[model samples]
Target: MNLVERDEQESELERIWSECGAGKGSVVLLEGSGGSGKTELLHQAAERARRGGGLVLHAGCSPAESALPFGVLGQLFSSVPAVEGPLARLQAPNSPLAAEAAPHDPARGAVAIGPQLALLLNEVTATLLELSAAKPVFIGVDTVRHADAQSLACLLYLVRRTGAARVMAVLTDDTAAHRSPFRTELLDQPHTRRVPLAPLAEAEITALLARQLERDEAERLAGEFHTLSGGNLLLLRALLEDHLACGGVRKDGYGRAVL
Candidate 1:
Protein backbone atom coordinates (compact mmCIF):
# COMPACT_ATOMS: atom_id res chain seq x y z
CA MET A 1 0.00 0.00 0.00
CA ASN A 2 1.10 3.50 -0.72
CA LEU A 3 2.12 5.57 2.27
CA VAL A 4 -0.74 8.00 2.70
CA GLU A 5 0.72 11.14 4.28
CA ARG A 6 3.92 11.08 6.28
CA ASP A 7 5.90 14.08 5.22
CA GLU A 8 7.56 14.38 8.58
CA GLN A 9 8.76 10.78 8.51
CA GLU A 10 9.87 11.07 4.91
CA SER A 11 11.79 14.24 5.63
CA GLU A 12 13.42 12.63 8.60
CA LEU A 13 14.63 9.76 6.41
CA GLU A 14 15.86 12.15 3.76
CA ARG A 15 17.71 14.07 6.40
CA ILE A 16 19.46 10.91 7.53
CA TRP A 17 20.46 10.13 3.98
CA SER A 18 21.74 13.62 3.38
CA GLU A 19 23.73 13.79 6.59
CA CYS A 20 25.12 10.26 6.60
CA GLY A 21 25.34 9.26 2.96
CA ALA A 22 28.66 11.04 2.63
CA GLY A 23 30.50 7.82 3.48
CA LYS A 24 30.06 8.73 7.10
CA GLY A 25 28.38 6.33 9.48
CA SER A 26 24.81 7.07 10.57
CA VAL A 27 21.87 5.25 12.15
CA VAL A 28 18.16 6.06 12.09
CA LEU A 29 15.64 4.42 14.39
CA LEU A 30 11.97 4.41 13.43
CA GLU A 31 9.84 3.13 16.30
CA GLY A 32 6.09 2.60 16.17
CA SER A 33 3.36 0.12 16.98
CA GLY A 34 2.18 -2.51 14.51
CA GLY A 35 0.36 -0.97 11.53
CA SER A 36 1.81 2.45 12.25
CA GLY A 37 3.48 2.48 8.82
CA LYS A 38 7.09 1.96 9.82
CA THR A 39 7.65 -0.81 7.27
CA GLU A 40 6.14 1.35 4.52
CA LEU A 41 8.44 4.17 5.49
CA LEU A 42 11.46 1.89 5.25
CA HIS A 43 10.31 0.69 1.85
CA GLN A 44 10.17 4.29 0.69
CA ALA A 45 13.69 4.88 1.92
CA ALA A 46 14.90 1.80 0.08
CA GLU A 47 13.41 3.19 -3.12
CA ARG A 48 15.29 6.39 -2.59
CA ALA A 49 18.49 4.43 -2.20
CA ARG A 50 17.86 2.47 -5.37
CA ARG A 51 17.29 5.63 -7.36
CA GLY A 52 20.64 6.92 -6.19
CA GLY A 53 22.37 3.79 -7.55
CA GLY A 54 23.05 2.36 -4.11
CA LEU A 55 22.66 -1.30 -3.24
CA VAL A 56 19.88 -2.13 -0.79
CA LEU A 57 19.96 -5.04 1.64
CA HIS A 58 16.73 -5.95 3.40
CA ALA A 59 16.20 -8.35 6.33
CA GLY A 60 13.21 -8.86 8.56
CA CYS A 61 13.40 -10.27 12.08
CA SER A 62 10.85 -12.81 13.22
CA PRO A 63 10.50 -14.75 16.47
CA ALA A 64 10.55 -18.12 14.76
CA GLU A 65 13.42 -17.27 12.43
CA SER A 66 15.55 -15.70 15.14
CA ALA A 67 16.61 -19.07 16.49
CA LEU A 68 18.19 -19.99 13.16
CA PRO A 69 21.91 -19.22 13.37
CA PHE A 70 23.28 -16.55 11.05
CA GLY A 71 19.78 -16.13 9.67
CA VAL A 72 20.18 -12.46 8.89
CA LEU A 73 23.77 -12.78 7.74
CA GLY A 74 22.79 -15.63 5.51
CA GLN A 75 20.09 -13.51 3.96
CA LEU A 76 22.52 -10.65 3.41
CA PHE A 77 25.12 -12.92 1.87
CA SER A 78 22.66 -14.41 -0.54
CA SER A 79 21.39 -10.99 -1.60
CA VAL A 80 24.80 -9.69 -2.69
CA PRO A 81 27.46 -11.50 -4.72
CA ALA A 82 30.69 -12.54 -3.11
CA VAL A 83 33.30 -9.82 -2.78
CA GLU A 84 36.49 -11.54 -4.00
CA GLY A 85 38.78 -8.65 -3.07
CA PRO A 86 37.40 -8.45 0.44
CA LEU A 87 37.62 -12.22 0.83
CA ALA A 88 41.22 -12.16 -0.33
CA ARG A 89 41.97 -9.41 2.15
CA LEU A 90 40.50 -11.52 4.95
CA GLN A 91 42.49 -14.67 4.25
CA ALA A 92 45.63 -15.28 6.30
CA PRO A 93 48.93 -15.61 4.50
CA ASN A 94 49.50 -19.14 5.90
CA SER A 95 45.87 -20.31 5.62
CA PRO A 96 45.32 -23.46 3.55
CA LEU A 97 42.39 -21.95 1.66
CA ALA A 98 44.66 -19.01 0.83
CA ALA A 99 47.05 -21.45 -0.84
CA GLU A 100 44.65 -23.43 -3.05
CA ALA A 101 41.05 -24.51 -3.04
CA ALA A 102 39.39 -27.56 -4.57
CA PRO A 103 36.03 -26.68 -6.15
CA HIS A 104 33.85 -28.59 -3.67
CA ASP A 105 36.01 -28.89 -0.59
CA PRO A 106 33.64 -28.59 2.37
CA ALA A 107 36.49 -28.27 4.87
CA ARG A 108 38.07 -25.46 2.90
CA GLY A 109 34.64 -23.82 2.62
CA ALA A 110 34.20 -24.03 6.37
CA VAL A 111 37.63 -22.53 7.03
CA ALA A 112 36.93 -19.67 4.63
CA ILE A 113 33.35 -18.93 5.71
CA GLY A 114 34.27 -17.41 9.08
CA PRO A 115 36.80 -14.88 7.84
CA GLN A 116 34.74 -14.46 4.72
CA LEU A 117 31.72 -13.50 6.76
CA ALA A 118 33.72 -10.79 8.47
CA LEU A 119 35.17 -9.63 5.18
CA LEU A 120 31.77 -9.77 3.58
CA LEU A 121 30.28 -7.50 6.22
CA ASN A 122 33.21 -5.11 5.82
CA GLU A 123 32.78 -5.22 2.06
CA VAL A 124 29.09 -4.57 2.43
CA THR A 125 29.94 -1.53 4.50
CA ALA A 126 32.51 -0.52 1.94
CA THR A 127 30.03 -0.99 -0.87
CA LEU A 128 27.65 1.31 0.96
CA LEU A 129 30.43 3.80 1.31
CA GLU A 130 31.30 3.47 -2.35
CA LEU A 131 27.68 3.99 -3.41
CA SER A 132 27.38 7.00 -1.16
CA ALA A 133 30.75 8.25 -2.26
CA ALA A 134 28.75 10.58 -4.40
CA LYS A 135 25.31 9.87 -2.86
CA PRO A 136 24.17 7.56 0.02
CA VAL A 137 23.64 3.90 0.85
CA PHE A 138 20.48 2.72 2.57
CA ILE A 139 20.30 -0.38 4.79
CA GLY A 140 16.85 -1.18 6.10
CA VAL A 141 15.76 -3.58 8.83
CA ASP A 142 12.19 -4.26 9.91
CA THR A 143 10.83 -5.82 13.12
CA VAL A 144 14.17 -5.22 14.77
CA ARG A 145 12.86 -6.20 18.18
CA HIS A 146 12.53 -9.73 16.90
CA ALA A 147 16.06 -9.78 15.45
CA ASP A 148 18.31 -12.55 16.64
CA ALA A 149 20.93 -11.86 19.28
CA GLN A 150 23.73 -12.44 16.75
CA SER A 151 22.19 -10.01 14.29
CA LEU A 152 21.73 -7.48 17.07
CA ALA A 153 25.38 -7.85 18.01
CA CYS A 154 26.47 -7.37 14.42
CA LEU A 155 24.24 -4.30 14.14
CA LEU A 156 25.86 -2.84 17.22
CA TYR A 157 29.24 -3.51 15.66
CA LEU A 158 28.11 -1.74 12.50
CA VAL A 159 26.88 1.29 14.41
CA ARG A 160 30.20 1.62 16.17
CA ARG A 161 32.32 1.12 13.06
CA THR A 162 30.21 2.62 10.28
CA GLY A 163 31.11 6.28 10.79
CA ALA A 164 34.13 6.13 8.53
CA ALA A 165 32.01 4.47 5.88
CA ARG A 166 29.06 6.26 4.38
CA VAL A 167 26.11 4.07 5.34
CA MET A 168 22.70 4.80 6.86
CA ALA A 169 21.12 1.94 8.75
CA VAL A 170 17.41 2.36 9.30
CA LEU A 171 15.73 0.08 11.82
CA THR A 172 12.01 -0.12 12.60
CA ASP A 173 10.18 -1.93 15.36
CA ASP A 174 6.87 -2.06 17.18
CA THR A 175 7.33 0.05 20.27
CA ALA A 176 4.31 -1.39 22.08
CA ALA A 177 6.05 -4.73 22.40
CA HIS A 178 9.06 -5.45 24.56
CA ARG A 179 11.75 -2.87 23.90
CA SER A 180 14.64 -4.07 21.78
CA PRO A 181 18.10 -4.19 23.26
CA PHE A 182 19.47 -3.11 19.90
CA ARG A 183 17.14 -0.12 19.98
CA THR A 184 18.49 0.87 23.35
CA GLU A 185 22.05 0.45 22.16
CA LEU A 186 21.48 2.55 19.05
CA LEU A 187 19.86 5.31 21.10
CA ASP A 188 22.85 5.41 23.41
CA GLN A 189 25.23 5.72 20.49
CA PRO A 190 26.27 9.05 19.08
CA HIS A 191 24.78 10.39 15.81
CA THR A 192 21.69 8.22 16.01
CA ARG A 193 18.22 9.69 15.41
CA ARG A 194 14.98 8.24 16.75
CA VAL A 195 11.53 8.95 15.36
CA PRO A 196 8.37 7.75 17.10
CA LEU A 197 5.35 7.28 14.85
CA ALA A 198 1.83 8.04 16.03
CA PRO A 199 -1.54 7.68 14.28
CA LEU A 200 -2.59 9.99 11.48
CA ALA A 201 -4.54 13.19 12.12
CA GLU A 202 -8.13 13.78 11.02
CA ALA A 203 -7.18 16.00 8.09
CA GLU A 204 -4.64 13.44 6.88
CA ILE A 205 -7.33 10.80 7.07
CA THR A 206 -9.66 13.04 5.09
CA ALA A 207 -7.02 13.55 2.44
CA LEU A 208 -6.42 9.82 2.26
CA LEU A 209 -10.08 9.07 1.74
CA ALA A 210 -10.38 11.78 -0.88
CA ARG A 211 -7.63 10.11 -2.84
CA GLN A 212 -9.25 6.68 -2.50
CA LEU A 213 -12.93 7.54 -2.95
CA GLU A 214 -15.14 10.25 -4.44
CA ARG A 215 -15.19 13.55 -2.61
CA ASP A 216 -18.78 13.24 -1.41
CA GLU A 217 -18.30 9.63 -0.48
CA ALA A 218 -15.14 10.54 1.40
CA GLU A 219 -16.86 13.42 3.16
CA ARG A 220 -19.75 11.25 4.24
CA LEU A 221 -17.53 8.51 5.62
CA ALA A 222 -14.77 10.66 7.08
CA GLY A 223 -16.35 11.32 10.45
CA GLU A 224 -17.45 7.75 10.94
CA PHE A 225 -14.08 6.44 9.92
CA HIS A 226 -12.37 8.77 12.32
CA THR A 227 -14.66 7.60 15.06
CA LEU A 228 -14.07 3.98 14.26
CA SER A 229 -10.32 4.14 13.70
CA GLY A 230 -9.27 6.96 16.00
CA GLY A 231 -6.86 8.04 13.20
CA ASN A 232 -5.01 4.74 13.25
CA LEU A 233 -4.00 4.17 9.63
CA LEU A 234 -4.10 0.37 9.64
CA LEU A 235 -7.40 0.18 11.44
CA LEU A 236 -8.89 2.84 9.20
CA ARG A 237 -7.93 1.01 6.02
CA ALA A 238 -9.23 -2.32 7.31
CA LEU A 239 -12.46 -0.74 8.51
CA LEU A 240 -12.99 0.94 5.14
CA GLU A 241 -12.49 -2.35 3.34
CA ASP A 242 -14.90 -4.04 5.72
CA HIS A 243 -17.45 -1.26 5.30
CA LEU A 244 -17.36 -1.61 1.52
CA ALA A 245 -17.87 -5.36 1.79
CA CYS A 246 -20.83 -4.95 4.15
CA GLY A 247 -22.85 -2.89 1.61
CA GLY A 248 -22.03 0.31 3.35
CA VAL A 249 -22.87 3.13 1.00
CA ARG A 250 -22.11 6.81 0.86
CA LYS A 251 -24.65 8.95 2.67
CA ASP A 252 -26.36 11.95 1.09
CA GLY A 253 -26.63 15.34 2.82
CA TYR A 254 -29.59 14.16 4.89
CA GLY A 255 -27.46 11.17 6.09
CA ARG A 256 -29.43 8.52 4.17
CA ALA A 257 -27.29 5.65 2.94
CA VAL A 258 -27.56 5.37 -0.83
CA LEU A 259 -27.08 1.80 -2.00
Candidate 2:
Protein backbone atom coordinates (compact mmCIF):
# COMPACT_ATOMS: atom_id res chain seq x y z
CA MET A 1 0.00 0.00 0.00
CA ASN A 2 1.13 3.52 -0.73
CA LEU A 3 2.03 5.46 2.40
CA VAL A 4 -0.03 8.51 3.36
CA GLU A 5 0.87 11.30 5.75
CA ARG A 6 4.34 9.82 6.02
CA ASP A 7 6.46 12.11 3.91
CA GLU A 8 8.43 13.33 6.88
CA GLN A 9 9.05 9.78 8.09
CA GLU A 10 10.22 8.71 4.69
CA SER A 11 12.52 11.71 4.40
CA GLU A 12 14.04 10.97 7.78
CA LEU A 13 14.59 7.35 6.79
CA GLU A 14 16.17 8.40 3.52
CA ARG A 15 18.54 10.68 5.37
CA ILE A 16 19.49 7.89 7.73
CA TRP A 17 20.04 5.51 4.84
CA SER A 18 22.26 8.05 3.10
CA GLU A 19 24.27 8.59 6.26
CA CYS A 20 24.67 4.83 6.64
CA GLY A 21 26.12 4.66 3.16
CA ALA A 22 28.54 7.42 4.17
CA GLY A 23 30.11 5.30 6.94
CA LYS A 24 27.99 6.72 9.74
CA GLY A 25 26.13 3.69 11.08
CA SER A 26 23.06 4.19 13.27
CA VAL A 27 20.00 2.40 14.65
CA VAL A 28 16.36 3.19 13.88
CA LEU A 29 13.42 2.00 15.93
CA LEU A 30 10.00 2.18 14.26
CA GLU A 31 7.62 2.24 17.15
CA GLY A 32 3.87 2.00 16.64
CA SER A 33 0.65 0.28 17.62
CA GLY A 34 -0.65 -2.79 15.81
CA GLY A 35 -1.82 -2.10 12.24
CA SER A 36 -0.17 1.34 12.41
CA GLY A 37 2.03 0.57 9.35
CA LYS A 38 5.29 -0.12 11.14
CA THR A 39 5.98 -3.20 9.05
CA GLU A 40 5.19 -1.38 5.83
CA LEU A 41 7.52 1.48 6.72
CA LEU A 42 10.26 -1.00 7.64
CA HIS A 43 9.95 -2.80 4.29
CA GLN A 44 10.01 0.53 2.47
CA ALA A 45 13.12 1.57 4.35
CA ALA A 46 14.82 -1.74 3.55
CA GLU A 47 13.96 -1.37 -0.11
CA ARG A 48 15.39 2.14 -0.08
CA ALA A 49 18.58 0.86 1.51
CA ARG A 50 18.85 -1.95 -0.99
CA ARG A 51 18.37 0.43 -3.91
CA GLY A 52 21.08 2.65 -2.42
CA GLY A 53 23.61 -0.21 -2.83
CA GLY A 54 23.53 -1.45 0.73
CA LEU A 55 23.58 -5.18 1.45
CA VAL A 56 20.16 -5.69 2.99
CA LEU A 57 19.58 -8.44 5.52
CA HIS A 58 15.96 -8.51 6.56
CA ALA A 59 14.13 -10.86 8.96
CA GLY A 60 10.80 -11.06 10.74
CA CYS A 61 10.50 -12.13 14.36
CA SER A 62 7.44 -13.81 15.88
CA PRO A 63 6.20 -15.20 19.15
CA ALA A 64 6.18 -18.76 17.82
CA GLU A 65 9.97 -18.84 17.44
CA SER A 66 10.82 -16.50 20.28
CA ALA A 67 12.31 -19.37 22.31
CA LEU A 68 14.39 -20.74 19.49
CA PRO A 69 17.98 -19.64 20.15
CA PHE A 70 19.59 -17.65 17.35
CA GLY A 71 16.38 -18.04 15.32
CA VAL A 72 16.40 -14.47 14.04
CA LEU A 73 20.13 -14.60 13.36
CA GLY A 74 19.70 -17.75 11.32
CA GLN A 75 17.00 -16.09 9.22
CA LEU A 76 19.20 -13.07 8.59
CA PHE A 77 22.34 -14.87 7.35
CA SER A 78 20.76 -17.97 5.85
CA SER A 79 20.34 -16.35 2.44
CA VAL A 80 23.36 -14.00 2.44
CA PRO A 81 26.47 -15.83 1.32
CA ALA A 82 28.82 -12.95 2.10
CA VAL A 83 28.40 -13.35 5.85
CA GLU A 84 28.06 -17.14 5.85
CA GLY A 85 31.55 -17.81 7.20
CA PRO A 86 30.82 -16.69 10.75
CA LEU A 87 27.22 -17.88 10.61
CA ALA A 88 28.36 -21.38 9.65
CA ARG A 89 30.11 -21.89 12.95
CA LEU A 90 27.30 -20.23 14.86
CA GLN A 91 24.80 -22.69 13.42
CA ALA A 92 26.99 -25.77 13.53
CA PRO A 93 26.04 -28.45 15.99
CA ASN A 94 27.75 -28.09 19.38
CA SER A 95 29.21 -24.71 18.37
CA PRO A 96 30.52 -22.39 21.08
CA LEU A 97 27.41 -20.24 20.73
CA ALA A 98 25.17 -23.20 21.32
CA ALA A 99 22.54 -23.07 24.04
CA GLU A 100 24.57 -25.39 26.29
CA ALA A 101 27.56 -23.09 25.98
CA ALA A 102 25.99 -20.56 28.28
CA PRO A 103 28.28 -20.39 31.31
CA HIS A 104 27.05 -21.74 34.60
CA ASP A 105 28.46 -20.04 37.62
CA PRO A 106 29.01 -23.06 39.87
CA ALA A 107 29.73 -20.77 42.78
CA ARG A 108 26.64 -18.67 42.41
CA GLY A 109 24.51 -21.46 40.93
CA ALA A 110 23.28 -19.07 38.25
CA VAL A 111 23.74 -19.11 34.51
CA ALA A 112 26.12 -16.38 33.41
CA ILE A 113 26.88 -15.35 29.85
CA GLY A 114 30.66 -15.58 29.82
CA PRO A 115 33.36 -15.28 27.19
CA GLN A 116 31.77 -17.83 24.89
CA LEU A 117 28.73 -15.68 24.16
CA ALA A 118 30.84 -12.56 24.08
CA LEU A 119 33.15 -14.07 21.51
CA LEU A 120 30.25 -15.18 19.39
CA LEU A 121 28.61 -11.75 19.56
CA ASN A 122 31.87 -10.12 18.57
CA GLU A 123 32.32 -12.59 15.74
CA VAL A 124 28.92 -11.75 14.24
CA THR A 125 29.44 -8.03 14.80
CA ALA A 126 32.88 -8.28 13.22
CA THR A 127 31.43 -10.02 10.20
CA LEU A 128 29.01 -7.12 9.58
CA LEU A 129 31.70 -4.52 10.22
CA GLU A 130 33.99 -6.34 7.82
CA LEU A 131 31.25 -6.57 5.20
CA SER A 132 30.63 -2.83 5.65
CA ALA A 133 34.27 -2.29 4.80
CA ALA A 134 33.44 -3.17 1.22
CA LYS A 135 29.80 -1.98 1.01
CA PRO A 136 27.13 -0.54 3.24
CA VAL A 137 25.06 -3.11 5.15
CA PHE A 138 21.45 -2.71 6.18
CA ILE A 139 20.01 -5.04 8.81
CA GLY A 140 16.25 -4.77 9.04
CA VAL A 141 14.38 -6.79 11.64
CA ASP A 142 10.62 -6.64 12.09
CA THR A 143 8.82 -7.09 15.42
CA VAL A 144 11.91 -7.07 17.58
CA ARG A 145 9.69 -7.58 20.57
CA HIS A 146 9.40 -11.22 19.56
CA ALA A 147 13.05 -11.77 18.67
CA ASP A 148 14.77 -14.57 20.55
CA ALA A 149 17.00 -13.72 23.47
CA GLN A 150 20.23 -14.74 21.75
CA SER A 151 19.41 -12.91 18.51
CA LEU A 152 18.41 -9.85 20.50
CA ALA A 153 21.81 -9.99 22.19
CA CYS A 154 23.56 -10.05 18.84
CA LEU A 155 21.47 -7.14 17.57
CA LEU A 156 22.13 -5.14 20.73
CA TYR A 157 25.85 -5.74 20.37
CA LEU A 158 25.83 -4.62 16.76
CA VAL A 159 23.78 -1.50 17.55
CA ARG A 160 26.33 -0.36 20.14
CA ARG A 161 29.36 -0.88 17.87
CA THR A 162 27.99 0.33 14.51
CA GLY A 163 28.84 4.02 15.05
CA ALA A 164 31.78 4.22 12.62
CA ALA A 165 30.90 1.51 10.11
CA ARG A 166 28.84 1.68 6.94
CA VAL A 167 25.97 -0.20 8.55
CA MET A 168 22.40 0.58 9.56
CA ALA A 169 20.03 -1.52 11.64
CA VAL A 170 16.31 -0.77 11.44
CA LEU A 171 14.01 -2.54 13.87
CA THR A 172 10.24 -2.36 14.42
CA ASP A 173 8.36 -2.95 17.62
CA ASP A 174 4.76 -2.59 18.72
CA THR A 175 4.45 0.22 21.24
CA ALA A 176 1.77 -1.69 23.14
CA ALA A 177 4.02 -4.66 23.83
CA HIS A 178 6.13 -5.08 26.92
CA ARG A 179 9.48 -3.34 26.53
CA SER A 180 12.27 -5.70 27.40
CA PRO A 181 15.49 -4.57 29.02
CA PHE A 182 17.40 -5.50 25.89
CA ARG A 183 15.12 -3.30 23.78
CA THR A 184 15.43 -0.51 26.33
CA GLU A 185 19.22 -0.72 26.16
CA LEU A 186 19.17 -0.77 22.36
CA LEU A 187 16.94 2.31 22.23
CA ASP A 188 19.16 4.08 24.79
CA GLN A 189 22.16 4.02 22.45
CA PRO A 190 23.40 7.50 21.55
CA HIS A 191 23.00 6.98 17.80
CA THR A 192 19.57 5.37 17.97
CA ARG A 193 16.59 7.30 16.52
CA ARG A 194 13.01 6.48 17.41
CA VAL A 195 10.22 7.03 14.90
CA PRO A 196 6.78 6.76 16.42
CA LEU A 197 3.88 6.11 14.03
CA ALA A 198 0.25 6.93 14.64
CA PRO A 199 -2.95 6.07 12.82
CA LEU A 200 -3.73 8.01 9.65
CA ALA A 201 -5.70 11.25 9.79
CA GLU A 202 -9.15 11.79 8.23
CA ALA A 203 -7.75 13.72 5.29
CA GLU A 204 -5.14 11.10 4.63
CA ILE A 205 -7.84 8.45 4.75
CA THR A 206 -9.87 10.39 2.23
CA ALA A 207 -6.83 10.72 0.01
CA LEU A 208 -6.28 6.98 0.25
CA LEU A 209 -9.87 6.32 -0.68
CA ALA A 210 -9.65 8.71 -3.57
CA ARG A 211 -6.91 6.53 -5.00
CA GLN A 212 -9.41 3.67 -5.29
CA LEU A 213 -12.69 5.44 -6.01
CA GLU A 214 -13.90 8.69 -7.56
CA ARG A 215 -13.04 11.87 -5.64
CA ASP A 216 -16.64 12.74 -4.67
CA GLU A 217 -17.45 9.19 -3.68
CA ALA A 218 -14.20 8.96 -1.71
CA GLU A 219 -15.04 12.17 0.12
CA ARG A 220 -18.57 10.89 0.76
CA LEU A 221 -17.42 7.67 2.41
CA ALA A 222 -14.33 9.04 4.14
CA GLY A 223 -16.11 10.13 7.32
CA GLU A 224 -17.94 6.85 7.91
CA PHE A 225 -14.87 4.83 6.96
CA HIS A 226 -12.65 6.82 9.26
CA THR A 227 -15.16 6.44 12.06
CA LEU A 228 -15.45 2.68 11.56
CA SER A 229 -11.75 2.05 11.17
CA GLY A 230 -10.57 4.64 13.65
CA GLY A 231 -8.08 5.85 10.96
CA ASN A 232 -6.20 2.55 10.92
CA LEU A 233 -4.72 1.95 7.50
CA LEU A 234 -5.23 -1.81 7.62
CA LEU A 235 -8.86 -1.55 8.67
CA LEU A 236 -9.43 1.26 6.20
CA ARG A 237 -8.10 -0.92 3.41
CA ALA A 238 -10.36 -3.75 4.43
CA LEU A 239 -13.33 -1.43 4.42
CA LEU A 240 -12.39 -0.24 0.97
CA GLU A 241 -12.16 -3.80 -0.24
CA ASP A 242 -15.60 -4.45 1.16
CA HIS A 243 -16.97 -1.39 -0.55
CA LEU A 244 -15.50 -2.45 -3.85
CA ALA A 245 -16.73 -6.02 -3.48
CA CYS A 246 -20.26 -5.33 -2.27
CA GLY A 247 -20.80 -2.07 -4.16
CA GLY A 248 -21.16 -0.32 -0.84
CA VAL A 249 -20.20 -0.55 2.82
CA ARG A 250 -22.31 -3.17 4.59
CA LYS A 251 -22.16 -2.92 8.36
CA ASP A 252 -22.98 -6.63 8.61
CA GLY A 253 -20.11 -7.66 6.35
CA TYR A 254 -16.58 -6.09 6.31
CA GLY A 255 -17.80 -3.32 8.56
CA ARG A 256 -18.71 -5.87 11.23
CA ALA A 257 -15.55 -7.81 10.41
CA VAL A 258 -13.42 -4.73 11.04
CA LEU A 259 -15.27 -3.95 14.22
Residue pairs clashing, model 1: 23-165, 23-166, 24-166, 25-163
Tens digits of per-residue lDDT for model 1 on 73-149? 44544454544454343343554433222223332221122454555556655654455566555678888766655
137-228: candidate 2 lDDT, tens digit per residue: 88899998787776776777678898889988889988887756676787789889998887788888888898879999998998999888
Best by lDDT: 2
Model 2 misplacement above 4 A: 94-96, 99-112
lDDT at position 106, candidate 2? 28
Q: Give residue 75's error in model 2 in angstroms.
A: 1.4
Candidate 1: C-alpha lDDT: 0.66
| lDDT to native, each model | 0.66, 0.79
Q: Each candidate's TM vs. the true structure?
A: 0.73, 0.88
